[model samples]
Target: MKCLQEQAADGTHLLFLAAVYKLLYLLYTKDAATVDHVLRHRSRRDFERIEQSMQYVKRNYTNPITLKETADELSLTPEYFCRLFKKYTGQTFLTYVNQIRLQYFHSDLLQTDESITYLMNKNGITNYKVFLRSFKEAYGMPPGQLRKKQREVRDAGAISARSASSSGND
Candidate 1:
């Protein structure tokens, strides 16, 4: 204040420039902090939205789930929702949905003797090619092969158990 008043008295532009520079520096520092705080808040909110979208996917993945419908439920545009989903999950929406379906398919495959085609359809997988590709990608083998391997292990275990039981009986 004193310097500016003195500058005004002398009509010197130097002091005016200095004051302007100081004001700008202070404003910039304050604005940067404000921007950071806002970004943190926005980031937390965005993550919450992403979580909500995931829950929505889990609930509806057994049926036909569209990106647009999920986005609409969250009041976000499909494009933005897709971007956010991929950014957080490292997978696109359709891929995520198919992943969930594949998980269900894997569980059913292990627990039941259902045909692969029937299991795929039951898990909402409509495209045979896509299902085969995704399943192989996920499990490193086709569904039928995995099932066969599991059965082989089971049979081996059963045979060992039976032999052990016979020896014990003797």
Candidate 2:
């Protein structure tokens, strides 16, 4: 890519970073949505409050956290905090909390045999419809279908491994 060559002229180390950025730029250009999403992740000024809010969300996502409470912690009014949070994070406070909850939900979904309803409750995801929509948007499939597919893949892998071992013995 032209981007990489420009960086390569600077130094060899920069060439690797240039390649990565070039790929990222291509991805960003190909998908308008990705460009929007990536732009939101850029570091902004007054990031201390944003970082604090993110830490609070990470620590308290399993519980019911409110915007007012988070704002109060940062000595900002709810309205100002809401604006600042959205400006820096590209998502609403509630949506950020749900994203964290969904992350843990996804991990537990793959690692445990618990029921989805129980997992939802544990993750503080109260609205099934919204959660389902968000889940599908994030994962490209419904939870039940994803779980079923993973099970089938795991079972098939085990069967293949067993066959290989038995054939080796023979």
Q: Please write out the lDDT profile of model 2 over residues 32-147, one tens digit for every residue.
A: 78667666664443478889989998888878889999999888899989998898789898889999999999989988999999999988888999999999999999998888
lDDT (10s digit) by residue, model 1, range 8-110? 7897877769899999999999999999999999889889999998898788777788999999998999999999999988999888888889999999999
User: Which pairs, if any, clash in model 1?
Assistant: none
Question: Lowest lDDT 10-mer window, candidate 2?
Answer: 37-46
lDDT over C-alpha atoms for residue 23 of model 1? 100
TM-scores for the candidates: 0.87, 0.70
CA displacement after TM-score superposition, residue 97 of candidate 1 (Å): 1.3
For candidate 1, the per-residue lDDT at 147 reads 98
Q: Which stretches of candidate 2 lie over 4 Å from their true place?
A: 1-45
Model 1 has a clash total of 0
Residue 62, model 1, lDDT: 70
